[model samples]
Target: MNDEEARTRLLDAAEALFYAEGIQAVGMDRIRTESGIPLKRLYRLYPAKEALVTAYLERRDRRWMASLSAATRGQADPVGAVFEWLAEWFSEPDFRGCAFLNAYGELGAGPAGVLDVVRRHKAELRALLAGIAGPGREGLAEQLLLLVEGATVVAALEPGPGAAVRAREAAYVLVRADGTG
Candidate 1:
Protein backbone atom coordinates (compact mmCIF):
# COMPACT_ATOMS: atom_id res chain seq x y z
CA MET A 1 0.00 0.00 0.00
CA ASN A 2 1.05 3.54 -0.66
CA ASP A 3 1.48 6.16 2.03
CA GLU A 4 -2.07 7.54 1.63
CA GLU A 5 -3.59 4.07 1.57
CA ALA A 6 -1.74 3.10 4.72
CA ARG A 7 -2.83 6.31 6.40
CA THR A 8 -6.46 5.70 5.44
CA ARG A 9 -6.33 2.16 6.79
CA LEU A 10 -4.83 3.38 10.04
CA LEU A 11 -7.44 6.10 10.42
CA ASP A 12 -10.29 3.72 9.56
CA ALA A 13 -9.01 1.19 12.10
CA ALA A 14 -8.44 3.79 14.76
CA GLU A 15 -11.82 5.42 14.17
CA ALA A 16 -13.69 2.15 14.61
CA LEU A 17 -11.81 0.89 17.65
CA PHE A 18 -11.72 4.27 19.35
CA TYR A 19 -15.46 4.71 18.90
CA ALA A 20 -16.39 1.15 19.84
CA GLU A 21 -13.89 0.42 22.63
CA GLY A 22 -12.67 3.85 23.72
CA ILE A 23 -9.21 5.25 23.17
CA GLN A 24 -7.45 3.89 26.20
CA ALA A 25 -8.55 0.37 25.38
CA VAL A 26 -7.32 0.69 21.78
CA GLY A 27 -3.55 0.77 21.93
CA MET A 28 -1.09 1.34 19.11
CA ASP A 29 -0.47 -2.37 18.80
CA ARG A 30 -4.13 -3.07 18.18
CA ILE A 31 -4.31 -0.41 15.49
CA ARG A 32 -1.22 -1.85 13.83
CA THR A 33 -2.73 -5.31 13.92
CA GLU A 34 -6.10 -4.20 12.65
CA SER A 35 -4.86 -1.86 9.98
CA GLY A 36 -2.21 -4.28 8.67
CA ILE A 37 0.18 -1.35 8.54
CA PRO A 38 3.69 -1.97 9.65
CA LEU A 39 5.05 -0.27 12.78
CA LYS A 40 7.50 1.80 10.80
CA ARG A 41 4.82 3.23 8.53
CA LEU A 42 2.48 3.90 11.45
CA TYR A 43 5.13 5.71 13.41
CA ARG A 44 6.26 7.64 10.37
CA LEU A 45 2.70 8.83 9.75
CA TYR A 46 1.74 9.40 13.36
CA PRO A 47 4.55 9.70 15.88
CA ALA A 48 2.21 9.11 18.83
CA LYS A 49 -1.02 7.27 19.56
CA GLU A 50 -2.67 10.54 20.48
CA ALA A 51 -1.68 11.98 17.12
CA LEU A 52 -3.24 9.06 15.34
CA VAL A 53 -6.42 9.50 17.32
CA THR A 54 -6.39 13.19 16.49
CA ALA A 55 -5.99 12.49 12.81
CA TYR A 56 -8.89 10.07 12.96
CA LEU A 57 -11.03 12.85 14.36
CA GLU A 58 -9.95 15.19 11.60
CA ARG A 59 -10.97 12.65 9.02
CA ARG A 60 -14.34 12.21 10.71
CA ASP A 61 -14.91 15.95 10.85
CA ARG A 62 -14.27 16.39 7.17
CA ARG A 63 -16.49 13.49 6.18
CA TRP A 64 -19.33 14.65 8.41
CA MET A 65 -19.18 18.24 7.18
CA ALA A 66 -19.09 17.16 3.58
CA SER A 67 -22.06 14.89 4.02
CA LEU A 68 -24.01 17.57 5.82
CA SER A 69 -23.21 20.20 3.25
CA ALA A 70 -24.24 17.99 0.39
CA ALA A 71 -27.47 17.03 2.09
CA THR A 72 -28.41 20.65 2.65
CA ARG A 73 -27.31 22.08 -0.65
CA GLY A 74 -29.88 24.45 -2.21
CA GLN A 75 -32.43 23.89 0.47
CA ALA A 76 -34.56 27.03 0.61
CA ASP A 77 -35.16 26.85 4.32
CA PRO A 78 -32.16 26.80 6.59
CA VAL A 79 -34.13 25.25 9.43
CA GLY A 80 -35.02 22.33 7.20
CA ALA A 81 -31.40 21.95 6.27
CA VAL A 82 -30.41 21.53 9.91
CA PHE A 83 -33.12 18.94 10.53
CA GLU A 84 -32.18 17.11 7.39
CA TRP A 85 -28.66 16.86 8.67
CA LEU A 86 -29.84 15.43 11.99
CA ALA A 87 -32.29 13.13 10.24
CA GLU A 88 -29.58 11.77 8.00
CA TRP A 89 -27.44 11.14 11.05
CA PHE A 90 -30.32 9.23 12.58
CA SER A 91 -30.60 7.27 9.36
CA GLU A 92 -27.14 5.82 9.75
CA PRO A 93 -27.23 2.15 10.78
CA ASP A 94 -24.23 2.55 13.06
CA PHE A 95 -24.47 6.22 13.88
CA ARG A 96 -23.13 5.73 17.38
CA GLY A 97 -22.33 9.15 18.85
CA CYS A 98 -20.81 12.16 17.25
CA ALA A 99 -17.19 11.27 16.66
CA PHE A 100 -16.10 14.58 18.16
CA LEU A 101 -17.99 13.91 21.36
CA ASN A 102 -16.52 10.43 21.55
CA ALA A 103 -13.08 11.85 21.03
CA TYR A 104 -13.65 14.38 23.77
CA GLY A 105 -14.57 11.61 26.16
CA GLU A 106 -11.50 9.63 25.23
CA LEU A 107 -9.08 12.51 25.38
CA GLY A 108 -10.61 14.17 28.42
CA ALA A 109 -9.36 17.78 28.70
CA GLY A 110 -6.00 17.20 27.14
CA PRO A 111 -4.46 20.35 25.63
CA ALA A 112 -4.10 18.93 22.17
CA GLY A 113 -4.86 20.37 18.76
CA VAL A 114 -7.39 17.58 18.34
CA LEU A 115 -9.37 18.89 21.29
CA ASP A 116 -9.32 22.30 19.71
CA VAL A 117 -10.60 20.86 16.46
CA VAL A 118 -13.40 19.10 18.30
CA ARG A 119 -14.40 22.23 20.17
CA ARG A 120 -14.30 24.37 17.10
CA HIS A 121 -16.37 21.94 15.09
CA LYS A 122 -19.04 21.81 17.81
CA ALA A 123 -19.05 25.57 18.06
CA GLU A 124 -19.44 25.88 14.32
CA LEU A 125 -22.36 23.48 14.47
CA ARG A 126 -24.00 25.59 17.12
CA ALA A 127 -23.48 28.70 15.07
CA LEU A 128 -24.91 27.03 12.03
CA LEU A 129 -27.96 25.93 13.97
CA ALA A 130 -28.36 29.39 15.39
CA GLY A 131 -28.07 30.98 12.00
CA ILE A 132 -30.78 28.73 10.69
CA ALA A 133 -32.84 29.34 13.81
CA GLY A 134 -32.44 33.03 12.91
CA PRO A 135 -31.45 36.17 14.79
CA GLY A 136 -32.40 36.96 18.41
CA ARG A 137 -32.58 33.28 19.26
CA GLU A 138 -29.29 32.64 20.94
CA GLY A 139 -30.97 30.57 23.62
CA LEU A 140 -32.58 28.41 20.94
CA ALA A 141 -29.18 27.35 19.64
CA GLU A 142 -28.07 26.17 23.07
CA GLN A 143 -31.32 24.32 23.65
CA LEU A 144 -31.37 22.62 20.26
CA LEU A 145 -27.70 21.83 20.56
CA LEU A 146 -28.25 20.04 23.86
CA LEU A 147 -31.20 18.15 22.42
CA VAL A 148 -29.23 16.95 19.42
CA GLU A 149 -26.34 15.90 21.63
CA GLY A 150 -28.75 14.04 23.87
CA ALA A 151 -30.34 12.37 20.86
CA THR A 152 -27.01 11.18 19.52
CA VAL A 153 -25.92 9.76 22.87
CA VAL A 154 -29.29 8.18 23.55
CA ALA A 155 -29.31 6.50 20.16
CA ALA A 156 -25.81 5.23 20.65
CA LEU A 157 -26.70 3.70 24.01
CA GLU A 158 -30.14 2.32 23.11
CA PRO A 159 -29.97 2.01 19.33
CA GLY A 160 -33.62 2.83 18.81
CA PRO A 161 -35.85 5.26 16.93
CA GLY A 162 -37.62 6.44 20.06
CA ALA A 163 -34.67 8.46 21.23
CA ALA A 164 -34.57 10.33 17.95
CA VAL A 165 -38.31 10.86 18.07
CA ARG A 166 -38.00 12.26 21.57
CA ALA A 167 -35.28 14.58 20.41
CA ARG A 168 -37.46 15.83 17.56
CA GLU A 169 -40.30 16.43 20.00
CA ALA A 170 -38.01 18.37 22.28
CA ALA A 171 -36.79 20.35 19.30
CA TYR A 172 -40.33 21.17 18.29
CA VAL A 173 -41.14 22.36 21.78
CA LEU A 174 -37.96 24.38 21.90
CA VAL A 175 -38.64 25.97 18.53
CA ARG A 176 -42.18 26.80 19.54
CA ALA A 177 -41.07 28.22 22.85
CA ASP A 178 -38.18 30.15 21.36
CA GLY A 179 -39.99 31.28 18.20
CA THR A 180 -37.13 30.09 16.04
CA GLY A 181 -38.75 27.35 14.05
Candidate 2:
Protein backbone atom coordinates (compact mmCIF):
# COMPACT_ATOMS: atom_id res chain seq x y z
CA MET A 1 0.00 0.00 0.00
CA ASN A 2 0.96 3.66 -0.37
CA ASP A 3 1.89 5.98 2.46
CA GLU A 4 -1.62 7.29 3.00
CA GLU A 5 -3.15 3.84 2.95
CA ALA A 6 -0.48 2.53 5.31
CA ARG A 7 -1.02 5.48 7.65
CA THR A 8 -4.76 4.91 7.77
CA ARG A 9 -4.30 1.20 8.42
CA LEU A 10 -1.85 1.88 11.20
CA LEU A 11 -4.20 4.40 12.80
CA ASP A 12 -7.17 2.06 12.48
CA ALA A 13 -5.29 -0.73 14.20
CA ALA A 14 -3.98 1.63 16.84
CA GLU A 15 -7.39 3.07 17.65
CA ALA A 16 -9.04 -0.36 17.98
CA LEU A 17 -6.28 -1.83 20.12
CA PHE A 18 -5.83 1.24 22.29
CA TYR A 19 -9.56 1.72 22.88
CA ALA A 20 -10.27 -1.97 23.50
CA GLU A 21 -7.28 -2.37 25.76
CA GLY A 22 -5.40 0.71 26.93
CA ILE A 23 -2.74 3.00 25.46
CA GLN A 24 0.25 1.84 27.51
CA ALA A 25 -0.75 -1.80 27.17
CA VAL A 26 -0.66 -1.87 23.39
CA GLY A 27 2.77 -1.70 21.80
CA MET A 28 3.98 -0.64 18.38
CA ASP A 29 4.83 -4.22 17.43
CA ARG A 30 1.25 -5.31 18.07
CA ILE A 31 0.00 -2.38 16.05
CA ARG A 32 2.30 -3.41 13.22
CA THR A 33 0.99 -6.95 13.38
CA GLU A 34 -2.64 -5.84 13.55
CA SER A 35 -2.31 -3.33 10.77
CA GLY A 36 -0.27 -5.67 8.61
CA ILE A 37 2.18 -2.81 8.20
CA PRO A 38 5.84 -3.63 8.43
CA LEU A 39 7.61 -2.58 11.62
CA LYS A 40 9.94 -0.29 9.73
CA ARG A 41 7.07 1.32 7.91
CA LEU A 42 5.02 1.70 11.11
CA TYR A 43 7.94 3.37 12.81
CA ARG A 44 8.54 5.49 9.77
CA LEU A 45 4.90 6.52 9.72
CA TYR A 46 4.79 7.34 13.42
CA PRO A 47 8.33 7.92 14.65
CA ALA A 48 7.25 6.75 18.13
CA LYS A 49 4.44 5.05 19.98
CA GLU A 50 3.48 8.37 21.56
CA ALA A 51 3.05 9.85 18.11
CA LEU A 52 0.79 6.95 17.18
CA VAL A 53 -1.25 7.37 20.34
CA THR A 54 -1.63 11.09 19.77
CA ALA A 55 -2.69 10.52 16.18
CA TYR A 56 -5.25 7.94 17.24
CA LEU A 57 -6.74 10.27 19.85
CA GLU A 58 -6.76 13.25 17.48
CA ARG A 59 -8.65 11.29 14.85
CA ARG A 60 -11.03 9.86 17.42
CA ASP A 61 -11.75 13.32 18.81
CA ARG A 62 -12.68 14.61 15.37
CA ARG A 63 -14.94 11.68 14.57
CA TRP A 64 -16.55 11.66 18.00
CA MET A 65 -17.40 15.37 17.88
CA ALA A 66 -18.65 15.07 14.33
CA SER A 67 -20.94 12.23 15.31
CA LEU A 68 -22.27 14.18 18.30
CA SER A 69 -22.87 17.29 16.20
CA ALA A 70 -24.66 15.28 13.53
CA ALA A 71 -26.87 13.64 16.12
CA THR A 72 -27.85 16.92 17.78
CA ARG A 73 -28.06 19.11 14.66
CA GLY A 74 -31.37 20.88 13.95
CA GLN A 75 -32.99 19.43 17.06
CA ALA A 76 -35.60 21.63 18.72
CA ASP A 77 -34.12 20.84 22.10
CA PRO A 78 -30.39 20.66 21.52
CA VAL A 79 -29.58 20.05 25.17
CA GLY A 80 -31.96 17.11 25.40
CA ALA A 81 -30.65 15.86 22.10
CA VAL A 82 -27.15 15.78 23.54
CA PHE A 83 -28.27 13.44 26.32
CA GLU A 84 -30.27 11.33 23.90
CA TRP A 85 -27.15 10.93 21.78
CA LEU A 86 -25.18 9.93 24.83
CA ALA A 87 -27.78 7.31 25.70
CA GLU A 88 -27.43 5.78 22.25
CA TRP A 89 -23.66 5.90 22.48
CA PHE A 90 -23.76 4.35 25.93
CA SER A 91 -25.87 1.49 24.62
CA GLU A 92 -23.42 0.65 21.88
CA PRO A 93 -22.04 -2.89 22.31
CA ASP A 94 -18.45 -1.63 22.33
CA PHE A 95 -19.19 1.35 24.55
CA ARG A 96 -16.33 1.89 27.00
CA GLY A 97 -16.77 5.34 28.46
CA CYS A 98 -14.90 8.31 26.92
CA ALA A 99 -11.80 7.45 24.96
CA PHE A 100 -10.22 10.80 25.79
CA LEU A 101 -10.82 10.21 29.49
CA ASN A 102 -9.40 6.73 29.18
CA ALA A 103 -6.30 8.12 27.49
CA TYR A 104 -5.92 10.79 30.13
CA GLY A 105 -6.20 8.24 32.89
CA GLU A 106 -3.56 6.13 31.20
CA LEU A 107 -1.08 8.75 30.07
CA GLY A 108 -1.98 12.15 31.42
CA ALA A 109 1.35 12.81 33.10
CA GLY A 110 3.45 11.55 30.21
CA PRO A 111 5.22 13.81 27.74
CA ALA A 112 2.84 12.76 25.03
CA GLY A 113 0.09 14.91 23.50
CA VAL A 114 -2.57 12.70 25.06
CA LEU A 115 -3.32 15.32 27.69
CA ASP A 116 -3.62 18.02 25.06
CA VAL A 117 -5.99 15.92 22.99
CA VAL A 118 -8.08 15.11 26.05
CA ARG A 119 -8.27 18.73 27.10
CA ARG A 120 -9.19 19.92 23.63
CA HIS A 121 -11.93 17.32 23.36
CA LYS A 122 -13.39 18.35 26.69
CA ALA A 123 -13.18 22.08 25.95
CA GLU A 124 -14.90 21.54 22.62
CA LEU A 125 -17.62 19.52 24.33
CA ARG A 126 -18.14 22.27 26.87
CA ALA A 127 -18.31 24.84 24.07
CA LEU A 128 -20.99 22.77 22.36
CA LEU A 129 -22.91 22.58 25.62
CA ALA A 130 -22.48 26.30 26.14
CA GLY A 131 -23.91 27.05 22.73
CA ILE A 132 -26.87 24.83 23.49
CA ALA A 133 -27.30 26.41 26.88
CA GLY A 134 -27.12 29.82 25.15
CA PRO A 135 -25.43 33.05 26.21
CA GLY A 136 -25.46 34.10 29.88
CA ARG A 137 -25.89 30.48 30.90
CA GLU A 138 -22.27 29.49 31.23
CA GLY A 139 -22.93 27.97 34.65
CA LEU A 140 -25.66 25.81 33.27
CA ALA A 141 -23.37 24.65 30.50
CA GLU A 142 -20.73 23.78 33.07
CA GLN A 143 -23.30 21.85 35.08
CA LEU A 144 -24.41 20.00 31.97
CA LEU A 145 -20.81 19.18 31.16
CA LEU A 146 -20.33 17.73 34.64
CA LEU A 147 -23.44 15.62 34.21
CA VAL A 148 -22.28 14.36 30.84
CA GLU A 149 -18.84 13.42 32.10
CA GLY A 150 -20.22 11.92 35.31
CA ALA A 151 -22.77 9.88 33.41
CA THR A 152 -20.10 8.58 31.05
CA VAL A 153 -17.99 7.39 33.99
CA VAL A 154 -20.99 5.88 35.75
CA ALA A 155 -22.13 4.17 32.58
CA ALA A 156 -18.69 2.67 32.18
CA LEU A 157 -18.85 1.26 35.70
CA GLU A 158 -22.44 -0.02 35.52
CA PRO A 159 -24.44 -2.07 33.13
CA GLY A 160 -27.01 -0.58 30.73
CA PRO A 161 -27.52 3.14 30.01
CA GLY A 162 -28.96 3.93 33.39
CA ALA A 163 -26.47 6.70 34.00
CA ALA A 164 -27.33 8.53 30.80
CA VAL A 165 -31.02 8.15 31.56
CA ARG A 166 -30.59 9.53 35.04
CA ALA A 167 -28.34 12.28 33.74
CA ARG A 168 -30.93 13.22 31.14
CA GLU A 169 -33.57 13.48 33.86
CA ALA A 170 -31.30 15.70 35.92
CA ALA A 171 -30.49 17.83 32.86
CA TYR A 172 -34.20 18.39 32.25
CA VAL A 173 -34.64 19.57 35.81
CA LEU A 174 -31.66 21.88 35.54
CA VAL A 175 -32.76 23.31 32.25
CA ARG A 176 -36.28 23.86 33.52
CA ALA A 177 -35.02 25.44 36.70
CA ASP A 178 -32.83 27.74 34.63
CA GLY A 179 -35.91 28.65 32.62
CA THR A 180 -34.22 27.57 29.42
CA GLY A 181 -36.14 24.39 28.76
Candidate 3:
Protein backbone atom coordinates (compact mmCIF):
# COMPACT_ATOMS: atom_id res chain seq x y z
CA MET A 1 0.00 0.00 0.00
CA ASN A 2 0.98 3.63 -0.46
CA ASP A 3 2.25 5.71 2.42
CA GLU A 4 -0.98 7.74 2.69
CA GLU A 5 -3.11 4.59 2.66
CA ALA A 6 -0.92 2.97 5.26
CA ARG A 7 -1.07 6.06 7.44
CA THR A 8 -4.84 6.20 7.24
CA ARG A 9 -5.17 2.53 8.09
CA LEU A 10 -2.85 2.91 11.04
CA LEU A 11 -4.78 5.91 12.33
CA ASP A 12 -8.11 4.15 11.88
CA ALA A 13 -6.84 1.23 13.92
CA ALA A 14 -5.26 3.46 16.52
CA GLU A 15 -8.40 5.56 16.98
CA ALA A 16 -10.63 2.53 17.36
CA LEU A 17 -8.41 0.65 19.79
CA PHE A 18 -7.33 3.65 21.83
CA TYR A 19 -10.81 5.15 22.17
CA ALA A 20 -12.35 1.78 23.04
CA GLU A 21 -9.64 0.52 25.36
CA GLY A 22 -7.71 3.59 26.51
CA ILE A 23 -4.37 4.67 25.06
CA GLN A 24 -2.09 2.94 27.54
CA ALA A 25 -3.94 -0.34 27.19
CA VAL A 26 -3.23 -0.71 23.45
CA GLY A 27 0.26 -1.27 22.15
CA MET A 28 1.93 -0.60 18.80
CA ASP A 29 1.96 -4.32 17.97
CA ARG A 30 -1.80 -4.46 18.37
CA ILE A 31 -2.19 -1.44 16.13
CA ARG A 32 0.02 -3.11 13.55
CA THR A 33 -1.99 -6.29 13.74
CA GLU A 34 -5.28 -4.44 13.54
CA SER A 35 -4.17 -2.16 10.70
CA GLY A 36 -2.44 -5.01 8.84
CA ILE A 37 0.61 -2.82 8.58
CA PRO A 38 4.04 -4.27 9.11
CA LEU A 39 5.77 -3.38 12.39
CA LYS A 40 8.76 -1.77 10.69
CA ARG A 41 6.53 0.37 8.51
CA LEU A 42 4.45 1.43 11.50
CA TYR A 43 7.57 2.54 13.30
CA ARG A 44 8.75 4.45 10.26
CA LEU A 45 5.38 6.14 9.97
CA TYR A 46 4.85 7.16 13.61
CA PRO A 47 8.38 6.93 15.06
CA ALA A 48 6.86 6.76 18.57
CA LYS A 49 3.62 5.75 20.24
CA GLU A 50 3.20 9.31 21.44
CA ALA A 51 3.23 10.51 17.85
CA LEU A 52 0.51 8.02 16.99
CA VAL A 53 -1.59 9.06 19.98
CA THR A 54 -1.22 12.73 19.13
CA ALA A 55 -2.19 12.13 15.52
CA TYR A 56 -5.23 10.10 16.57
CA LEU A 57 -6.41 12.85 18.89
CA GLU A 58 -5.78 15.61 16.36
CA ARG A 59 -7.73 13.80 13.69
CA ARG A 60 -10.49 12.95 16.10
CA ASP A 61 -10.71 16.60 17.13
CA ARG A 62 -11.16 17.69 13.55
CA ARG A 63 -13.75 15.03 12.81
CA TRP A 64 -15.64 15.57 16.05
CA MET A 65 -15.83 19.33 15.60
CA ALA A 66 -16.84 18.96 11.98
CA SER A 67 -19.66 16.62 12.97
CA LEU A 68 -20.85 18.98 15.66
CA SER A 69 -20.70 21.97 13.32
CA ALA A 70 -22.63 20.06 10.69
CA ALA A 71 -25.25 19.10 13.22
CA THR A 72 -25.70 22.66 14.42
CA ARG A 73 -25.36 24.33 11.08
CA GLY A 74 -28.25 26.51 9.83
CA GLN A 75 -30.10 26.02 13.07
CA ALA A 76 -31.95 28.99 14.52
CA ASP A 77 -30.70 28.10 17.93
CA PRO A 78 -27.21 26.68 17.65
CA VAL A 79 -26.87 26.34 21.42
CA GLY A 80 -29.92 24.12 21.64
CA ALA A 81 -28.76 22.25 18.59
CA VAL A 82 -25.53 21.38 20.34
CA PHE A 83 -27.36 19.68 23.18
CA GLU A 84 -29.64 17.91 20.76
CA TRP A 85 -26.58 16.59 18.99
CA LEU A 86 -25.09 15.51 22.31
CA ALA A 87 -28.27 13.63 23.16
CA GLU A 88 -27.96 11.60 20.01
CA TRP A 89 -24.27 11.02 20.57
CA PHE A 90 -24.89 9.92 24.14
CA SER A 91 -27.55 7.46 23.01
CA GLU A 92 -25.20 5.66 20.67
CA PRO A 93 -24.38 2.12 21.83
CA ASP A 94 -20.66 2.77 21.57
CA PHE A 95 -20.87 5.99 23.57
CA ARG A 96 -17.94 6.36 25.93
CA GLY A 97 -17.89 10.05 26.88
CA CYS A 98 -15.43 12.61 25.53
CA ALA A 99 -12.39 11.06 23.86
CA PHE A 100 -10.14 13.98 24.76
CA LEU A 101 -11.21 13.82 28.37
CA ASN A 102 -10.71 10.08 28.34
CA ALA A 103 -7.22 10.48 26.96
CA TYR A 104 -6.44 13.14 29.52
CA GLY A 105 -7.63 10.95 32.35
CA GLU A 106 -5.52 8.09 31.08
CA LEU A 107 -2.31 9.93 30.24
CA GLY A 108 -2.74 13.55 31.17
CA ALA A 109 0.63 13.74 32.87
CA GLY A 110 2.59 11.44 30.63
CA PRO A 111 2.90 13.32 27.35
CA ALA A 112 2.98 17.04 26.72
CA GLY A 113 1.63 16.63 23.21
CA VAL A 114 -1.32 14.61 24.43
CA LEU A 115 -2.17 17.15 27.09
CA ASP A 116 -1.85 20.01 24.58
CA VAL A 117 -4.20 18.29 22.18
CA VAL A 118 -6.75 17.72 24.91
CA ARG A 119 -6.61 21.33 25.96
CA ARG A 120 -6.84 22.55 22.39
CA HIS A 121 -9.87 20.39 21.74
CA LYS A 122 -11.63 21.79 24.78
CA ALA A 123 -10.71 25.35 23.90
CA GLU A 124 -12.09 24.87 20.44
CA LEU A 125 -15.31 23.47 21.82
CA ARG A 126 -15.61 26.45 24.11
CA ALA A 127 -14.97 28.79 21.21
CA LEU A 128 -17.71 27.10 19.23
CA LEU A 129 -20.06 27.50 22.15
CA ALA A 130 -19.09 31.14 22.47
CA GLY A 131 -19.81 31.81 18.82
CA ILE A 132 -23.17 30.18 19.27
CA ALA A 133 -23.82 32.33 22.29
CA GLY A 134 -22.95 35.47 20.27
CA PRO A 135 -21.94 38.81 21.68
CA GLY A 136 -22.56 39.90 25.26
CA ARG A 137 -22.93 36.23 26.26
CA GLU A 138 -19.42 35.16 27.07
CA GLY A 139 -20.49 34.08 30.52
CA LEU A 140 -23.34 32.09 29.04
CA ALA A 141 -20.92 30.34 26.73
CA GLU A 142 -18.77 29.33 29.68
CA GLN A 143 -21.84 28.12 31.55
CA LEU A 144 -23.03 26.18 28.55
CA LEU A 145 -19.60 24.60 28.18
CA LEU A 146 -19.78 23.42 31.79
CA LEU A 147 -23.16 21.89 31.20
CA VAL A 148 -21.96 20.14 28.08
CA GLU A 149 -18.89 18.70 29.76
CA GLY A 150 -20.81 17.72 32.89
CA ALA A 151 -23.54 16.08 30.88
CA THR A 152 -20.99 14.13 28.88
CA VAL A 153 -19.52 12.70 32.08
CA VAL A 154 -22.92 11.94 33.50
CA ALA A 155 -24.07 10.33 30.29
CA ALA A 156 -21.00 8.10 30.38
CA LEU A 157 -21.88 6.85 33.83
CA GLU A 158 -25.57 6.37 33.11
CA PRO A 159 -26.94 4.75 30.01
CA GLY A 160 -29.21 6.59 27.56
CA PRO A 161 -29.51 10.36 27.02
CA GLY A 162 -31.01 11.45 30.29
CA ALA A 163 -28.07 13.63 31.20
CA ALA A 164 -28.18 15.48 27.90
CA VAL A 165 -31.90 15.99 28.17
CA ARG A 166 -31.57 17.43 31.64
CA ALA A 167 -28.64 19.55 30.54
CA ARG A 168 -30.57 20.87 27.56
CA GLU A 169 -33.44 21.85 29.73
CA ALA A 170 -31.11 23.58 32.14
CA ALA A 171 -29.39 25.35 29.28
CA TYR A 172 -32.70 26.67 27.99
CA VAL A 173 -33.51 27.98 31.43
CA LEU A 174 -30.14 29.66 31.63
CA VAL A 175 -30.51 31.23 28.23
CA ARG A 176 -34.02 32.38 29.00
CA ALA A 177 -32.96 33.80 32.33
CA ASP A 178 -30.11 35.57 30.64
CA GLY A 179 -32.71 37.16 28.32
CA THR A 180 -31.29 35.54 25.22
CA GLY A 181 -33.46 32.45 24.85
lDDT per residue for candidate 1 within 62-176, as digits (tens), equals 7876776676567785455556567667667767777888878877789487798899888877876676576888888888788878888887777656666777777788888
Q: Which stretches of candidate 1 lie over 4 Å from their true place?
A: 76-88
| Two-way TM-score contest, 1 vs 2, winner | 2
Candidate 2 residue lDDT tens string, 53-157: 889989998999999988888999888788889888899888888999998888766844777888899999999889889999999999999999999999888
TM-score on alpha carbons, each prediction: 0.86, 0.97, 0.97
> Candidate 2: where are CA atoms >4 Å away?
none
Q: Candidate 3: where are CA atoms >4 Å away?
A: none
Ranking of all candidate structures by their lDDT, best first: 3, 2, 1
Candidate with best lDDT: 3
> Model 1, 48: alpha-carbon shift in Å?
0.3
